[model samples]
Target: MENEKTGEVLRVASDEERDQAIIDAGFIPGWIGEGGLRPEPLHDFEPDTWNWETGRALLEAAATSINPRVAERRNIRMANSAAEKRTSLNTIHCSYQMVAPGEFARAHRHTINAGRFILESKGAFTTLEGKKVFMEPNDIILTPNWLWHGLGNENLEAPAFWIDFLDDPLVAALKTIFFEVRDEDYKEMPIKEGSHHHIRWRDLDLQLEDLVPDPNGRYGKRLQLQTPSIPTMRLYIERFDKHMTVNPVKSTANHLFICAEGSGTTKVEDKTFNWQRGDVIAVPSWKLFNHRASINATLLEITDQPVIEALGWYRETTV
Candidate 1:
């Protein structure tokens, strides 16, 4: 028998091998043998179930059936997420998240375009663009590139859950996905309470009235709500509830939309697609499209138009 820990070796009968000798000495074999297999890498188990198109569809469908009121008061938990191949394109990332009553997710921001759709929660909320909008289970929120945002529980008794999406490829491509923490735990400064920078669900309708038809024929109806001058745009619930407007966007960059409430249809080129709460639609660069709501709806739309314009690559046309 041999005691490796104490550097002592004892000779046993030639007929007894290492295994038998250890048993005779009342000691267990703790070391792994040479023939044992090693563990596999995590990339080997990457997700095979989701693609960009399918993932977006599944998220939209799930959001439509969620109960906002209950989610607000109760808590929900998110399951593990699987990755998709299209992730290589546009450096996009997607995941699901759920939270229960009394649980809170930390506030954060990055240089990517981050979008979220409430999966469940009645009184949950997302503070973006300086406004705290109650996150009805199906509502959608947008955290544009380099913006500060946070989530909260409005109803003390309810839970909340939502999905997160980011243009990871763009950030990775640019090699600039920097994140910073605020000293106050939240970035509640730099914006005024009643300023245009802050927008709520109620502000949707008021903002829509400000949309004027396109003076040039480049778009059926074009309203540059936000630009480099503003840096952000807000479409409140009221504006989404009004008559569906068809505005053509001549794209130089990708167009992103987050459904806040209700359902709608979008005409992309020659095709029309139905959209509901929590749906995140991404129109690729240089595409022509128009949006219509079935009923009153609220939506937060964003785009890389600023990036294109800055690079002198933006152009739009309307017929």
Candidate 2:
């Protein structure tokens, strides 16, 4: 397996070697001892960014070379390889996905929850269970854990692309990863010609004006989108007005933020990075950070708070 972060190849000469490697990585038959210390540090202190330009170039190349090789799937993830994902302490996975015209991503269900933020699409839709959910630019779609879902691009002249986010790390840690593919393609039933009422994540439209200011006044105006389909996670859209700066606060859980619109500068402790639309930023657990927008900015924030909070291990403090 190719390790993206270190550019190293991990060779597995035999099944025994692979199983031993998996066990050495902190699991025994899919179970980790409750009090055993991890061999690896769970998180990275320095934040990193995945530039949109690089991602697009990779995706375009993948659409040609990689898309055809995999059956009903073509994706480039932001993490390392399958064995070592460095995206976050929680192992949140983000990827750029593409499906050529008339192509289909085979129907499958998994124990790990997932979501998609459609960046570009034309006549693209996903079938979750038996309902057809249309994809439009900026539309967010939910594919909850254990739900049978598949993707398709029906437009003849164009391909569709989107950002895929999943809580695979958490599932891997729990050793509860489960996946199954359907034997046949999921047929989309006909719907009212213009109705978009079946779009699950689109159920609530974002209205910035309707949001009350954050009580802490740390983050500027904010709107939290609850994806009931994936009840274990929460998503937020944070808005920063021109010249506005957010107060520093320690993160209670790992967060992956994508600049959906405008430009800004984020400071994680002493390190800072300038970000614009399409750039992704990862904030590992316990990092103190804040941001200032050069212009009005909007970010899509995904976090592992649901799992952390459930475990009663989440914490945060604002100065």
Candidate 3:
């Protein structure tokens, strides 16, 4: 048989006895064939869009039964529907998190880098290094590896919600996952102002108002968030005018996009994902995708492009 990818050819074994002997010796001859090696990359996870309305209801239903004191967190992992996945993506994961009124999840730190994009918050705060960073809708709060952080919703009238994106899968594959919990109380943590860790929505929105699309017209009005501190992922916010459609491209970067405002539709290969405020869409590496705003909209994208680029494996092609 011909193996064009590796430029090798296979022939019938001239010595079955020797092959049997090799097997008996706990060895498989490399000349026979290869199972795991392939010519091109095969992204294992499926591209999927998770709706806020659907996830919100499920989280609401589970709120009463899910006790943060025992469960560690009350969040819904956005597990990919394909491959019977336990994570949202291969290298990264996203979860829908809810902090019920009057609930407090204790402070802890882990080797996994994580951040959250607030969807709704009347009164919710993340205690970062013993300081409370109040969460406002459309804000992004980062908790890098080994940063002691906890969450609480002291507002008695309503719960707080957010979408957390983490590089836990990458750490898991490297067998470097470590976590620890703090036994101390977080009730007395003081509020922090002008924290570099919090990216206020009001500020970003004001900035996006004056920006325009790429010179190549590949995307809508876009701004790349500075990220020297976070090496694994890249964050960007793109604003689209009503009924606008831009160029589609495929690249070797897995992406997760959260709808921060208005409504839109994203086309990923053969799939069409209709999204509204608070919805999230997951796109696997190398899939052609583009977006169109039914109304003026904003999308916050978190991607593993940095990791891919650091490995010198990043590539792209316009579709």
TM-score to true structure, per model:
0.52, 0.78, 0.90
lDDT of 1 by residue, 12-45 (tens): 4453466677777797555534434544211211
Give lDDT tens digits, candidate 3, residues 1-319: 3223334433333567557656776999666755567766788799998899998999999999999989999999999989779888898899999999888998899999999999889989998899999999999998988889999998998999999999998999999999999955666667899888899999999999899877786889999987566789899999999998988989999999999999989999999999999899999998999999999999999999999998999999996
| Model 1 stretches with alpha carbons more than 4 Å out | 1-97, 107-109, 113-150, 154-156, 161-167, 180-197, 210-250, 296-298
- In Å, residue 112's CA in model 3 sits off its true spot by 0.5
How many collisions per candidate?
26, 0, 0
Which regions in candidate 2 have their CA more than 4 angstroms from the true location? 1-46, 68-72, 80-89, 183-188, 191-206
The whole-model C-alpha lDDT of candidate 1 against the native structure comes to 0.51
Q: Give candidate 3 misplaced runs (Cα > 4 Å).
A: 1-39
Give per-model CA RMSD: 14.7, 10.3, 4.9
What TM-score does model 3 achieve against the real structure? 0.90
Write down the TM-score for model 1.
0.52
- Best-fitting candidate, scored by TM-score: 3
Error of 3 at 87 (Å): 1.1
Task: Quote the positional error of residue 147 for candidate 2 in Å.
Answer: 0.5
